[model samples]
Target: MPVSLHGQLVVAISARALFDFEAENQVFEAGDDRAYMALQQQRLDEPAPRGVAFSLVEKLLAFNEGGAPQVEVVVLSRNDPISGMRVFRSARHYGLPIERGVFTRGASPWRYLKPLSAQLFLSTNEADVRQALQAGVAAARVMPQAARASAAHPHELRIAFDGDAVLFSDEAEQVFQRDGLAAFQAHETSRAHQPLPAGPFKPVLEALQRLQHSTGGGMKVRTALVTARSAPAHERAIRTLMDWQIEVDEAMFLGGLPKGEFLREFEPDFFFDDQAGHIASAAAHVPAGHVAMGVAAGQG
Candidate 1:
């Protein structure tokens, strides 16, 4: 029988998103693949340091430790096969049970998400992330320089997401952006009973919810919907989740407050948002990734 990843919460990540390849990425950015490959080959014996998404991947893999696999982490990278050697070695060093990967040399690797059945895709390359989003996969562009995840939640996998363009569709958000705050509020208040359309990351949130229930390991999944909407507008967002029958551990209606301090308290393994400003703020307190789609990406 052919191997399959069906029914698993598969996450596709890039070599740089999995490990600190920023320095070597600089070499690649200088437009020399051979030199970059050589540098990675030279460091094959030395394990690369953990990147921003490392903690999240580690905790998710923990779910598969004691029983049937409930989660899978696949390396979908743009690095060449030679550099992929270092990636696997680093995973082995960290004891991360990541066993599969795709090294495309310099080619775009996001196209493979379909076959992998990945619910999430993380990469340092914004173009790759955007492409994955266009393909309808829950994707994020990891900020390499973001603060590392906190050790506070070793037994728990905490993830945070934005509302508009993330967990729910950007329909209402487009109103807010085009008109003003008042119009957005009125629009949402009028349609408070109608559930908003599904967003790109909704499937990811649903998968996490399922994983939380079926995971055989001791690790737990905690999720939060931290959004800029408040009061009247907030009602619709909450109602939308209710319509979908998904539950979140926490929900923050900050009314456009700076998300850094609030995220500091949350201490998520990772945070996903569509807006660049919110990502920049949260990156200071915790690991954050940009969901480059919807109204926030100006693509909705």
Candidate 2:
């Protein structure tokens, strides 16, 4: 029999997304691969600080304990193999039981997602994220400067997502982009009974739903739909989820209001949004990932 990732909730994350490697990244950006590798080599023994997604990873990994392992977090990084030593050491220092990795030097690591059977891919690089999404893997470009998850929930994994271009298609977003808010609301209102199309992160939500159902007695998963649509427009988003048979623990239709304070209250381990402005606002209050999809992502 061969080893398999089948039936396991696999997550692939980059070193930069999982740890605070900004200083090293600055050096790598300023210099060449040689300089970055040398610097990483020099700091091999020093454990890196927790990055924005650290809390999310930590909570997700908790599901593996006290039973059959249901979750696997793999390092899918662009760092050279030499630099990977520090990544492993940092994980160990933080007590994260991550044992697998794919270090591609300066090359893109998205190619390994298929072999790993990864359900989700998180990285600091937008290009890699875009490529992963194209390959049908749920992927997000992590906002490195985003605020870390709060320490309020230890045994629960709380995840949040935006509606359009995230869990739902960018059709409404396209209308909003083409016309104005009035037109967008009217469009959604007309199609309130119809289910909105699944967006890039829909697969991830489905996977999370499975994880939430399968895991027993150790760690629990809670999901939320936090969007900027309110009232009549909100009905369509709710109906879409209902049609998909996906149930989120909470839903917020903030309309045009700023999402930061509401997210701070939610204290999600991580949040994903397609729009950069929403991501920027949410990042100030919660760990956020940008799904670079649809018209908003195509914009500057």
Candidate 3:
């Protein structure tokens, strides 16, 4: 018999996204692979600190506590095999059950997302994240130095996402950015009942929904849709979700207000936004990921 991950919610993450490797990454960035390898080898037994996406991964993995296999997390990274030892050591140190990894030794690792059937890919490397997104996988460039998630929700995984260009197509956002607010509102008003197209992070949300329903005993999953659209425009967004038969626990149609303070109140384990400004705002309050797509692609 062959092994299968067909019914699982699989997530592929980079070594840097899962653990703090910024110091060592600096050496590699300076074009000295030998020094980087030596440094990693020297610190092989020392566990690395948790990075931006750690809490999210930890909470999601909790679903498989009794080995039910509802979730799968793979370390898909460009680190060399030697550095991968440090990653494994760090995972063990933190009591994470991560047991699979692919160290490409400086090569881009996004290609492996296909075989792994990854619903989500989180990495600090923008190019790798871009590749993953281009390949039709849900990906986000996680902020390595962002604040960790709030520990208040110990038994639940809370996630938040932007609306246009994130959970839905950037069509509406393009209209907003190019034609301004009044035109955008009018356009959405005409399409109030039409469901928007799915964006890069839609698969991630779908998988999270599956993980949330697969088991009833572990940490549960709660999600939110945080967008700048309000009023009649907001009606289209809600109608779109209803059209798809998907319901988020919360929805904030902030119009043009800053999302930082509102996100601080929600205290999500992680937040995903396409706009760099929104990422900047959210990063200050909670861990954030930059979904590099749509009108906001180049900035982040």
Question: If ranked by lDDT, best first, what sequence of candidates would result?
Answer: 1, 2, 3
Report the lDDT tens digits of candidate 3 across residue range 175-259: 9889999999999999998889998888778878876776634678899999999998999999988887788999999987999
Candidate 3 clashing pairs, residues 3+ apart or interchain = none
What's the TM for model 3?
Answer: 0.97
Model 2 sits at a Cα RMSD from the real structure of 1.4
Residue lDDT tens for model 1, 137-158: 9999999999999998788999
Better of 1 and 3 by TM-score: 1
The lDDT for every candidate, in the order shown, is 0.92, 0.91, 0.90
Q: Evaluate model 1: give its TM-score.
A: 0.98
lDDT of 3 at 21: 94
Per TM-score, what order, best first? 1, 3, 2
Span of 10 residues, lowest total lDDT, candidate 3: 210-219
* Candidate 2 structure quality by residue, lDDT tens digits, 1-300: 998878778999999999999999998899687998998999989999999999988988888777787788999999999999999999999999999999998898899999999989999999999999889888899999999999998888999999998898899999999998999999999999999988878878887887788664367889999998998899999999999999999999988788889999999999998888888889999999999888887542
- Which stretches in model 3 have alpha-carbon errors above 4 Å? none
Q: How accurate locally is residue 219 in candidate 2, as Cα lDDT from 0 to 100?
A: 77
Best by lDDT: 1
